[model samples]
Target: MTQSQHMQIQKTVFIITYGRSGSTLLQNMLNALPGYVLRGENANLLAPLVRSWQGLRRSEQAATMRARGTPSGPHQPWFGYEAIDADQLGQDLADVFLRQVLRPEADTRAVGFKEIRWHETPALFAPMLEFLQRYMPEAHFIFNTRAHEEVCRSGWWKTMDRRVVLDQLESAEQLYQDWQAAHPQRCLALHYNDYAQSPEAWQPLFEFLGEPYDAELVEAVLGRKLMHMKWQKPANRP
Candidate 1:
Protein backbone atom coordinates (compact mmCIF):
# COMPACT_ATOMS: atom_id res chain seq x y z
CA MET A 1 0.00 0.00 0.00
CA THR A 2 1.04 3.60 -0.45
CA GLN A 3 2.54 5.67 2.38
CA SER A 4 -0.64 7.68 2.62
CA GLN A 5 -2.67 4.50 2.94
CA HIS A 6 -0.33 3.24 5.62
CA MET A 7 -0.74 6.50 7.44
CA GLN A 8 -4.47 5.83 7.36
CA ILE A 9 -3.93 2.91 9.70
CA GLN A 10 -6.04 3.92 12.68
CA LYS A 11 -5.23 1.36 15.35
CA THR A 12 -1.96 -0.12 16.61
CA VAL A 13 -1.25 -2.63 19.35
CA PHE A 14 2.04 -3.44 21.06
CA ILE A 15 2.85 -6.26 23.46
CA ILE A 16 5.53 -5.03 25.85
CA THR A 17 7.28 -7.63 27.99
CA TYR A 18 10.49 -9.49 28.73
CA GLY A 19 11.39 -12.79 27.08
CA ARG A 20 9.91 -16.13 28.16
CA SER A 21 6.91 -14.28 29.50
CA GLY A 22 4.37 -16.02 27.19
CA SER A 23 4.31 -12.99 24.91
CA THR A 24 4.38 -15.22 21.86
CA LEU A 25 1.13 -16.72 23.06
CA LEU A 26 -0.38 -13.27 23.29
CA GLN A 27 0.99 -12.41 19.85
CA ASN A 28 -0.60 -15.51 18.37
CA MET A 29 -3.93 -14.77 20.00
CA LEU A 30 -3.98 -11.19 18.80
CA ASN A 31 -3.03 -12.25 15.28
CA ALA A 32 -5.93 -14.66 15.21
CA LEU A 33 -8.29 -11.73 15.27
CA PRO A 34 -9.59 -10.56 11.90
CA GLY A 35 -7.53 -7.77 10.30
CA TYR A 36 -4.97 -7.94 13.08
CA VAL A 37 -1.32 -8.58 12.28
CA LEU A 38 0.76 -8.70 15.42
CA ARG A 39 4.29 -9.69 14.48
CA GLY A 40 7.04 -11.27 16.53
CA GLU A 41 10.07 -9.66 18.13
CA ASN A 42 12.16 -7.09 16.21
CA ALA A 43 14.83 -6.86 18.92
CA ASN A 44 13.47 -3.50 20.01
CA LEU A 45 14.53 -1.86 16.72
CA LEU A 46 12.34 1.19 17.41
CA ALA A 47 14.37 2.02 20.53
CA PRO A 48 17.37 3.16 18.52
CA LEU A 49 15.13 5.23 16.25
CA VAL A 50 13.65 6.91 19.32
CA ARG A 51 17.15 7.55 20.66
CA SER A 52 18.25 9.10 17.38
CA TRP A 53 15.23 11.38 17.35
CA GLN A 54 15.95 12.41 20.95
CA GLY A 55 19.60 13.15 20.13
CA LEU A 56 18.55 15.24 17.14
CA ARG A 57 16.07 17.11 19.32
CA ARG A 58 18.78 17.88 21.86
CA SER A 59 21.11 19.06 19.08
CA GLU A 60 18.37 21.27 17.67
CA GLN A 61 17.85 22.85 21.09
CA ALA A 62 21.58 23.39 21.57
CA ALA A 63 21.94 24.88 18.09
CA THR A 64 19.13 27.33 18.82
CA MET A 65 20.97 28.52 21.93
CA ARG A 66 24.45 28.68 20.36
CA ALA A 67 23.38 30.22 17.04
CA ARG A 68 21.48 33.06 18.75
CA GLY A 69 19.42 34.01 15.63
CA THR A 70 22.47 33.67 13.33
CA PRO A 71 21.66 31.91 10.04
CA SER A 72 23.30 28.49 9.77
CA GLY A 73 25.74 28.03 6.85
CA PRO A 74 27.75 25.08 5.45
CA HIS A 75 30.99 26.76 6.62
CA GLN A 76 30.03 26.18 10.26
CA PRO A 77 30.52 22.82 12.04
CA TRP A 78 26.97 22.69 13.41
CA PHE A 79 25.53 24.18 10.22
CA GLY A 80 21.92 23.32 9.31
CA TYR A 81 21.32 21.66 12.68
CA GLU A 82 18.94 24.46 13.63
CA ALA A 83 16.85 23.77 10.53
CA ILE A 84 16.06 20.21 11.54
CA ASP A 85 12.44 19.48 12.44
CA ALA A 86 12.84 16.74 15.00
CA ASP A 87 9.11 16.07 15.30
CA GLN A 88 8.73 15.55 11.58
CA LEU A 89 11.81 13.33 11.56
CA GLY A 90 10.28 11.30 14.35
CA GLN A 91 6.99 10.97 12.45
CA ASP A 92 8.87 9.86 9.32
CA LEU A 93 10.69 7.21 11.33
CA ALA A 94 7.39 5.95 12.68
CA ASP A 95 5.99 5.85 9.17
CA VAL A 96 8.94 3.77 7.98
CA PHE A 97 8.33 1.35 10.83
CA LEU A 98 4.63 1.03 9.98
CA ARG A 99 5.17 0.60 6.24
CA GLN A 100 8.37 -1.47 6.24
CA VAL A 101 8.65 -3.31 9.53
CA LEU A 102 5.02 -3.95 10.42
CA ARG A 103 3.98 -4.02 6.76
CA PRO A 104 0.28 -4.23 7.36
CA GLU A 105 -1.82 -5.55 4.49
CA ALA A 106 -4.71 -3.75 2.81
CA ASP A 107 -7.19 -5.31 5.23
CA THR A 108 -5.13 -4.80 8.37
CA ARG A 109 -6.89 -2.76 11.04
CA ALA A 110 -4.32 -3.18 13.80
CA VAL A 111 -0.60 -3.87 13.39
CA GLY A 112 2.25 -4.15 15.89
CA PHE A 113 4.90 -6.48 17.31
CA LYS A 114 5.66 -8.14 20.58
CA GLU A 115 9.04 -6.94 21.84
CA ILE A 116 11.06 -8.51 24.66
CA ARG A 117 13.88 -5.98 24.72
CA TRP A 118 12.14 -3.00 26.32
CA HIS A 119 13.56 -3.86 29.74
CA GLU A 120 17.09 -3.94 28.41
CA THR A 121 17.33 -0.17 28.82
CA PRO A 122 15.42 0.95 31.88
CA ALA A 123 16.45 4.59 31.43
CA LEU A 124 15.16 4.75 27.84
CA PHE A 125 11.99 2.71 28.36
CA ALA A 126 9.66 5.61 29.15
CA PRO A 127 11.12 7.84 26.46
CA MET A 128 10.82 5.17 23.81
CA LEU A 129 7.19 4.47 24.77
CA GLU A 130 6.43 8.18 24.77
CA PHE A 131 7.93 8.54 21.30
CA LEU A 132 5.77 5.70 20.00
CA GLN A 133 2.59 7.19 21.43
CA ARG A 134 3.47 10.56 19.96
CA TYR A 135 4.22 9.23 16.49
CA MET A 136 2.39 5.95 15.95
CA PRO A 137 -1.31 6.18 15.13
CA GLU A 138 -3.72 5.37 17.94
CA ALA A 139 -1.12 3.26 19.77
CA HIS A 140 -2.26 0.85 22.48
CA PHE A 141 0.14 -0.92 24.81
CA ILE A 142 -0.27 -4.40 26.26
CA PHE A 143 2.00 -5.06 29.21
CA ASN A 144 2.51 -8.82 29.63
CA THR A 145 4.06 -10.35 32.69
CA ARG A 146 4.67 -13.75 34.23
CA ALA A 147 5.38 -14.31 37.90
CA HIS A 148 8.89 -13.20 38.77
CA GLU A 149 9.79 -16.57 40.29
CA GLU A 150 8.37 -18.44 37.31
CA VAL A 151 10.18 -16.17 34.89
CA CYS A 152 13.47 -16.59 36.71
CA ARG A 153 13.17 -20.37 36.45
CA SER A 154 12.20 -20.47 32.78
CA GLY A 155 14.40 -20.99 29.71
CA TRP A 156 17.76 -19.14 29.67
CA TRP A 157 16.80 -17.23 32.76
CA LYS A 158 17.34 -20.45 34.71
CA THR A 159 21.06 -20.20 33.98
CA MET A 160 21.37 -16.70 35.38
CA ASP A 161 21.63 -15.63 39.00
CA ARG A 162 18.11 -16.02 40.40
CA ARG A 163 18.29 -12.83 42.43
CA VAL A 164 19.49 -10.77 39.48
CA VAL A 165 16.85 -12.21 37.18
CA LEU A 166 14.09 -11.62 39.71
CA ASP A 167 15.21 -8.05 40.21
CA GLN A 168 15.16 -7.34 36.47
CA LEU A 169 11.72 -8.93 36.07
CA GLU A 170 10.32 -6.97 39.00
CA SER A 171 11.81 -3.74 37.74
CA ALA A 172 10.28 -4.27 34.31
CA GLU A 173 6.90 -5.10 35.85
CA GLN A 174 7.08 -1.90 37.87
CA LEU A 175 7.73 0.11 34.73
CA TYR A 176 4.71 -1.50 33.08
CA GLN A 177 2.59 -0.79 36.14
CA ASP A 178 3.64 2.84 36.27
CA TRP A 179 2.92 3.38 32.59
CA GLN A 180 -0.43 1.63 32.77
CA ALA A 181 -1.42 3.59 35.86
CA ALA A 182 -0.67 6.79 34.02
CA HIS A 183 -2.47 5.75 30.80
CA PRO A 184 -5.20 3.36 31.77
CA GLN A 185 -7.26 4.04 28.67
CA ARG A 186 -4.47 3.14 26.28
CA CYS A 187 -2.88 0.28 28.20
CA LEU A 188 -3.76 -3.25 29.28
CA ALA A 189 -1.77 -5.35 31.70
CA LEU A 190 -1.94 -9.13 31.43
CA HIS A 191 -0.36 -11.83 33.55
CA TYR A 192 0.52 -15.15 31.96
CA ASN A 193 -0.19 -17.08 35.12
CA ASP A 194 -3.59 -15.49 35.43
CA TYR A 195 -4.91 -16.31 31.97
CA ALA A 196 -2.75 -19.13 30.68
CA GLN A 197 -5.45 -21.76 31.21
CA SER A 198 -8.68 -19.82 31.58
CA PRO A 199 -10.57 -18.37 28.68
CA GLU A 200 -12.70 -16.30 31.06
CA ALA A 201 -9.55 -14.69 32.37
CA TRP A 202 -8.98 -13.08 28.97
CA GLN A 203 -12.34 -11.33 28.73
CA PRO A 204 -10.94 -8.11 30.08
CA LEU A 205 -8.14 -8.13 27.54
CA PHE A 206 -10.59 -8.58 24.67
CA GLU A 207 -12.85 -5.93 26.15
CA PHE A 208 -9.93 -3.54 26.47
CA LEU A 209 -9.17 -3.96 22.79
CA GLY A 210 -12.85 -3.69 21.85
CA GLU A 211 -12.65 -7.14 20.32
CA PRO A 212 -15.22 -9.85 20.90
CA TYR A 213 -14.01 -12.64 23.18
CA ASP A 214 -14.02 -15.93 21.34
CA ALA A 215 -13.88 -18.75 23.82
CA GLU A 216 -13.18 -21.39 21.22
CA LEU A 217 -10.34 -19.35 19.76
CA VAL A 218 -8.88 -18.68 23.16
CA GLU A 219 -9.07 -22.36 24.06
CA ALA A 220 -7.40 -23.37 20.84
CA VAL A 221 -4.62 -20.84 21.39
CA LEU A 222 -3.96 -22.05 24.91
CA GLY A 223 -3.93 -25.64 23.72
CA ARG A 224 -0.56 -25.25 22.03
CA LYS A 225 2.63 -23.60 23.16
CA LEU A 226 4.65 -21.19 21.06
CA MET A 227 8.44 -20.90 21.48
CA HIS A 228 8.51 -23.36 24.32
CA MET A 229 12.08 -24.51 24.98
CA LYS A 230 13.60 -27.22 27.10
CA TRP A 231 14.50 -26.17 30.59
CA GLN A 232 18.15 -25.22 30.95
CA LYS A 233 19.99 -25.79 34.19
CA PRO A 234 22.56 -23.40 35.56
CA ALA A 235 26.10 -24.28 34.51
CA ASN A 236 27.21 -24.61 38.15
CA ARG A 237 24.39 -26.97 39.04
CA PRO A 238 25.44 -30.56 39.59
Candidate 2:
Protein backbone atom coordinates (compact mmCIF):
# COMPACT_ATOMS: atom_id res chain seq x y z
CA MET A 1 0.00 0.00 0.00
CA THR A 2 1.20 3.54 -0.69
CA GLN A 3 1.82 6.09 2.06
CA SER A 4 -1.56 7.70 1.40
CA GLN A 5 -3.25 4.31 1.38
CA HIS A 6 -1.40 3.24 4.55
CA MET A 7 -2.61 6.39 6.26
CA GLN A 8 -6.12 5.44 5.30
CA ILE A 9 -5.94 2.00 6.97
CA GLN A 10 -4.55 3.77 10.06
CA LYS A 11 -4.50 0.82 12.44
CA THR A 12 -1.95 -1.50 14.03
CA VAL A 13 -3.58 -3.69 16.70
CA PHE A 14 -1.76 -5.22 19.65
CA ILE A 15 -3.50 -8.06 21.49
CA ILE A 16 -2.53 -7.30 25.10
CA THR A 17 -3.59 -9.71 27.86
CA TYR A 18 -2.85 -12.96 29.70
CA GLY A 19 -2.62 -16.51 28.39
CA ARG A 20 -5.43 -19.06 28.06
CA SER A 21 -7.84 -16.23 27.30
CA GLY A 22 -8.64 -17.26 23.74
CA SER A 23 -5.99 -14.87 22.39
CA THR A 24 -4.85 -17.47 19.88
CA LEU A 25 -8.32 -17.66 18.44
CA LEU A 26 -8.34 -13.89 18.20
CA GLN A 27 -4.93 -13.92 16.56
CA ASN A 28 -6.18 -16.33 13.94
CA MET A 29 -9.12 -14.07 13.24
CA LEU A 30 -6.91 -10.99 12.96
CA ASN A 31 -4.37 -12.77 10.77
CA ALA A 32 -7.07 -13.39 8.20
CA LEU A 33 -7.76 -9.67 7.88
CA PRO A 34 -7.26 -8.61 4.30
CA GLY A 35 -3.56 -7.74 3.86
CA TYR A 36 -2.87 -7.34 7.60
CA VAL A 37 0.16 -9.03 9.16
CA LEU A 38 -0.30 -10.74 12.52
CA ARG A 39 2.72 -11.97 14.50
CA GLY A 40 1.68 -13.99 17.56
CA GLU A 41 3.58 -13.72 20.92
CA ASN A 42 6.55 -12.00 19.27
CA ALA A 43 7.34 -9.74 22.24
CA ASN A 44 10.97 -10.29 23.29
CA LEU A 45 11.56 -6.98 25.09
CA LEU A 46 10.26 -8.16 28.50
CA ALA A 47 13.64 -9.74 29.15
CA PRO A 48 16.63 -7.96 30.73
CA LEU A 49 18.22 -6.85 27.42
CA VAL A 50 17.03 -8.67 24.35
CA ARG A 51 17.11 -6.78 21.05
CA SER A 52 14.01 -6.95 18.90
CA TRP A 53 11.15 -5.60 20.97
CA GLN A 54 8.00 -7.54 21.68
CA GLY A 55 6.31 -4.31 20.50
CA LEU A 56 4.99 -1.14 22.22
CA ARG A 57 3.11 -3.23 24.79
CA ARG A 58 6.29 -5.00 25.90
CA SER A 59 8.06 -1.67 25.97
CA GLU A 60 5.50 -0.69 28.63
CA GLN A 61 6.35 -3.84 30.61
CA ALA A 62 10.04 -2.99 30.46
CA ALA A 63 9.33 0.45 31.90
CA THR A 64 7.23 -1.10 34.68
CA MET A 65 10.10 -3.35 35.79
CA ARG A 66 12.50 -0.42 35.88
CA ALA A 67 10.19 1.59 38.14
CA ARG A 68 9.66 -1.33 40.49
CA GLY A 69 13.43 -1.98 40.68
CA THR A 70 12.65 -5.61 39.99
CA PRO A 71 13.85 -7.95 37.29
CA SER A 72 11.40 -9.29 34.72
CA GLY A 73 9.58 -12.30 36.15
CA PRO A 74 10.24 -15.76 34.67
CA HIS A 75 6.78 -16.42 33.17
CA GLN A 76 7.12 -13.12 31.33
CA PRO A 77 9.46 -14.19 28.57
CA TRP A 78 11.24 -12.16 25.85
CA PHE A 79 9.35 -13.69 22.96
CA GLY A 80 9.79 -13.08 19.21
CA TYR A 81 10.85 -14.54 15.89
CA GLU A 82 14.27 -16.24 16.28
CA ALA A 83 15.51 -14.37 13.24
CA ILE A 84 15.60 -11.17 15.26
CA ASP A 85 18.74 -9.88 16.97
CA ALA A 86 18.46 -9.11 20.70
CA ASP A 87 20.18 -5.70 20.40
CA GLN A 88 18.19 -4.16 17.53
CA LEU A 89 14.82 -5.56 18.60
CA GLY A 90 12.92 -2.94 20.56
CA GLN A 91 13.26 0.40 18.58
CA ASP A 92 12.68 -1.39 15.32
CA LEU A 93 10.30 -4.21 16.21
CA ALA A 94 7.34 -2.90 14.28
CA ASP A 95 9.40 -2.10 11.22
CA VAL A 96 11.14 -5.45 11.09
CA PHE A 97 8.02 -7.36 12.13
CA LEU A 98 6.06 -5.73 9.37
CA ARG A 99 8.60 -5.85 6.58
CA GLN A 100 10.30 -9.20 7.18
CA VAL A 101 7.74 -11.57 8.71
CA LEU A 102 4.10 -10.58 9.12
CA ARG A 103 3.82 -8.83 5.75
CA PRO A 104 4.73 -12.06 4.01
CA GLU A 105 2.14 -13.96 6.01
CA ALA A 106 -0.85 -11.80 5.12
CA ASP A 107 -1.13 -8.95 2.61
CA THR A 108 -2.85 -6.11 4.46
CA ARG A 109 -2.67 -2.41 5.30
CA ALA A 110 -2.21 -2.90 9.10
CA VAL A 111 0.03 -5.28 11.05
CA GLY A 112 0.59 -6.14 14.75
CA PHE A 113 2.14 -8.33 17.45
CA LYS A 114 -0.04 -10.90 19.24
CA GLU A 115 2.31 -11.84 22.09
CA ILE A 116 1.41 -10.61 25.64
CA ARG A 117 2.22 -11.40 29.27
CA TRP A 118 2.07 -10.18 32.95
CA HIS A 119 1.45 -6.68 31.61
CA GLU A 120 -2.15 -7.84 31.83
CA THR A 121 -2.35 -5.88 35.07
CA PRO A 122 -2.98 -2.27 34.16
CA ALA A 123 -0.57 -1.24 36.88
CA LEU A 124 1.97 -3.67 35.52
CA PHE A 125 1.54 -2.47 31.99
CA ALA A 126 1.28 1.23 32.83
CA PRO A 127 4.74 1.78 31.42
CA MET A 128 3.74 0.02 28.19
CA LEU A 129 0.86 2.28 27.06
CA GLU A 130 2.97 5.40 27.04
CA PHE A 131 5.81 3.55 25.38
CA LEU A 132 3.50 2.23 22.65
CA GLN A 133 1.99 5.63 21.96
CA ARG A 134 5.51 6.84 21.37
CA TYR A 135 6.93 3.77 19.65
CA MET A 136 4.50 2.65 16.97
CA PRO A 137 2.64 5.92 17.34
CA GLU A 138 -0.07 4.57 15.04
CA ALA A 139 -0.71 1.33 16.93
CA HIS A 140 -3.95 0.36 18.79
CA PHE A 141 -4.49 -2.26 21.51
CA ILE A 142 -7.04 -4.92 22.49
CA PHE A 143 -7.52 -5.92 26.13
CA ASN A 144 -8.98 -9.44 25.88
CA THR A 145 -10.72 -11.35 28.71
CA ARG A 146 -12.55 -14.55 29.62
CA ALA A 147 -14.50 -15.61 32.75
CA HIS A 148 -12.20 -15.94 35.79
CA GLU A 149 -13.16 -19.50 36.68
CA GLU A 150 -12.93 -20.54 33.08
CA VAL A 151 -9.58 -18.77 32.69
CA CYS A 152 -8.34 -20.59 35.78
CA ARG A 153 -9.62 -23.92 34.54
CA SER A 154 -8.25 -23.45 31.05
CA GLY A 155 -4.94 -22.16 32.39
CA TRP A 156 -4.57 -25.08 34.74
CA TRP A 157 -5.22 -27.61 32.03
CA LYS A 158 -2.76 -25.85 29.75
CA THR A 159 -0.17 -25.24 32.43
CA MET A 160 0.28 -28.34 34.58
CA ASP A 161 2.66 -26.31 36.71
CA ARG A 162 0.94 -25.20 39.92
CA ARG A 163 2.67 -21.83 40.09
CA VAL A 164 1.87 -20.64 36.53
CA VAL A 165 -1.77 -21.60 36.99
CA LEU A 166 -2.00 -19.69 40.27
CA ASP A 167 -0.40 -16.59 38.77
CA GLN A 168 -2.73 -16.47 35.74
CA LEU A 169 -5.86 -16.66 37.91
CA GLU A 170 -4.66 -13.97 40.27
CA SER A 171 -3.43 -11.68 37.51
CA ALA A 172 -6.09 -12.04 34.79
CA GLU A 173 -8.92 -10.18 36.53
CA GLN A 174 -6.72 -7.41 37.86
CA LEU A 175 -5.16 -6.91 34.40
CA TYR A 176 -8.61 -6.47 32.89
CA GLN A 177 -9.72 -3.98 35.51
CA ASP A 178 -6.44 -2.11 35.56
CA TRP A 179 -5.81 -1.57 31.82
CA GLN A 180 -9.42 -0.48 31.25
CA ALA A 181 -9.32 2.22 33.91
CA ALA A 182 -5.96 3.59 32.81
CA HIS A 183 -6.23 3.35 29.03
CA PRO A 184 -9.81 3.42 27.89
CA GLN A 185 -9.98 4.63 24.28
CA ARG A 186 -6.86 2.83 23.06
CA CYS A 187 -7.64 -0.41 24.83
CA LEU A 188 -10.65 -2.35 23.57
CA ALA A 189 -11.78 -5.07 26.02
CA LEU A 190 -13.61 -8.22 24.93
CA HIS A 191 -14.21 -11.72 26.23
CA TYR A 192 -12.99 -14.94 24.65
CA ASN A 193 -16.36 -16.53 25.40
CA ASP A 194 -18.11 -14.08 23.11
CA TYR A 195 -15.82 -15.00 20.25
CA ALA A 196 -16.92 -18.58 20.71
CA GLN A 197 -20.56 -17.70 21.38
CA SER A 198 -21.47 -15.50 18.44
CA PRO A 199 -20.25 -13.76 15.31
CA GLU A 200 -21.70 -10.51 16.61
CA ALA A 201 -19.11 -10.54 19.41
CA TRP A 202 -16.36 -9.70 16.92
CA GLN A 203 -18.16 -6.86 15.15
CA PRO A 204 -16.77 -4.21 17.48
CA LEU A 205 -13.23 -5.49 17.07
CA PHE A 206 -13.60 -5.61 13.31
CA GLU A 207 -14.84 -2.06 13.34
CA PHE A 208 -12.01 -1.01 15.65
CA LEU A 209 -9.44 -2.40 13.22
CA GLY A 210 -11.14 -0.67 10.27
CA GLU A 211 -12.02 -3.98 8.68
CA PRO A 212 -15.34 -5.59 7.84
CA TYR A 213 -16.19 -8.99 9.27
CA ASP A 214 -15.85 -11.49 6.48
CA ALA A 215 -18.09 -14.37 7.55
CA GLU A 216 -15.95 -16.50 5.29
CA LEU A 217 -12.72 -15.17 6.84
CA VAL A 218 -13.85 -15.62 10.45
CA GLU A 219 -15.08 -19.14 9.84
CA ALA A 220 -12.02 -20.11 7.86
CA VAL A 221 -9.61 -18.82 10.52
CA LEU A 222 -11.58 -20.03 13.54
CA GLY A 223 -12.40 -23.53 12.41
CA ARG A 224 -14.78 -26.02 13.99
CA LYS A 225 -17.41 -23.79 15.55
CA LEU A 226 -17.45 -20.80 17.90
CA MET A 227 -18.34 -22.18 21.30
CA HIS A 228 -17.53 -21.82 24.99
CA MET A 229 -14.26 -23.73 24.57
CA LYS A 230 -10.46 -23.30 24.68
CA TRP A 231 -7.00 -24.86 24.27
CA GLN A 232 -3.49 -24.43 25.75
CA LYS A 233 -0.15 -26.11 26.13
CA PRO A 234 0.45 -27.82 29.49
CA ALA A 235 3.10 -25.24 30.33
CA ASN A 236 0.69 -22.32 29.81
CA ARG A 237 -1.86 -23.44 32.44
CA PRO A 238 -1.09 -22.99 36.11
Question: Best candidate per lDDT, number?
Answer: 1
**Alpha carbon lDDT at 172, candidate 1:** 89
Question: For residue 82, what is the lDDT in candidate 1?
Answer: 77
Instruction: Show how many residue pairs clash in every candidate, following the order shown.
Output: 0, 22
lDDT of 2 at 166: 64
User: Which 10 residues in a row give candidate 1 its minimum summed lDDT?
Assistant: 229-238
Give the Cα error of residue 206 in candidate 2, in Å.
Answer: 1.2
lDDT for 160 in candidate 1 is 89
Question: Model 1 residue 186 lDDT?
Answer: 94
Clashing pairs in 1: none
Instruction: Give me the candidate number with maximum TM-score.
Output: 1
User: What lDDT, from 0 to 1, does candidate 2 have?
Assistant: 0.60
lDDT of each: 0.84, 0.60
**Model 2 shows how many backbone clashes?**
22
For candidate 1, the clash count comes to 0
lDDT for each residue of candidate 1 in 110-162, tens digit (9 for 90 to 100): 89999888988887898888888999889999999988888877888877899
